[model samples]
Target: MVERCKACGFCVEFCPTKVLALSSAFNSKGYHPPHVVNPEKCSGCDLCGMYCPDFAIYGYKLETGQAHVATAASAVHRAQRGPGNQSTGVEDEG
Candidate 1:
């Protein structure tokens, strides 16, 4: 699959693994789309796709018997545990 992301940023904000982020550039919808900043530490938890409002994010199972982010890794995943998605960089001031 091509990982047809809409760049809505919903998944980036709700990721539990803090692996997703909004691209500095905009998508076709004029929105800064979400992309994986890191892969080595991704853990392939698929939390991004779970809470995505537009289903823009998803997990891809690679041939190596491992699931991986479909795109090139790009943001630093700042893992935090709090009352909300803020723990995952989804909220700036949560």
Candidate 2:
């Protein structure tokens, strides 16, 4: 999904899954936003949004031609705890 990222790189640097990377292209603000370097590596966890200062980016789980935002408060908790959080446990309501 396209995001209005500010190119802070927080999403890339803090992403546990490391699916994101700085794109060669620059944003309107002249900063290079992160891109999907490996779509296969993405887990659609909202950890990127947790640390984003601009609140410009977040990930969504694509299912049945629809996208659901991975937004459980526990998602941040699970991220801090460890891996195996491939989908942010979408049903975990914190």
Candidate 3:
């Protein structure tokens, strides 16, 4: 999947799972937006998207009696990090 990021970094500031981070380089807009630097600790909760000003991140999950839920933020996390999250970062709520 394409990053579809504008490098606004708003998602990073609002990511509850802290799965996203600001890239060192800038995007086409010359902004350093958040990205899935670790792809292993995402909880697929979609908190970031819920608070994103530009909806840069997305997450998705399948519920199979595991209590997992599919969300735009969760889908974005899954797209980059897969199903398991092993990384850790600061928990910022927008």
For this target, which candidate reaches the highest TM-score against the unseen true structure?
2
Could you arrange the candidates by TM-score from highest to lowest? 2, 1, 3
TM-score of each: 0.56, 0.58, 0.54
Query: Which residue runs does candidate 3 get wrong by more than 4 Å?
Result: 1-8, 63-94
Report lDDT per candidate: 0.51, 0.53, 0.49
Query: Which is better, 2 or 3, measured by lDDT?
Result: 2
Tens digit of per-residue lDDT, candidate 3, span 1-94: 1235565566677766566676565556566655465455556666766766565555545352121222222222223333564233323222
User: On residues 1-94, what C-alpha lDDT tens digit does candidate 2 reach at each position?
Assistant: 2335566677778888786677676656566666555544556667877787876566765553222333212121113223553333234322
Which should have the higher TM-score, number 2 or number 3? 2
Candidates 1 and 2: which is better by lDDT? Answer: 2
For candidate 2, what is the TM-score? 0.58
Instruction: Give every collision pair in model 1.
Output: 7-33, 13-90, 37-74, 37-75
Poorest 10 consecutive residues by lDDT, candidate 1: 85-94
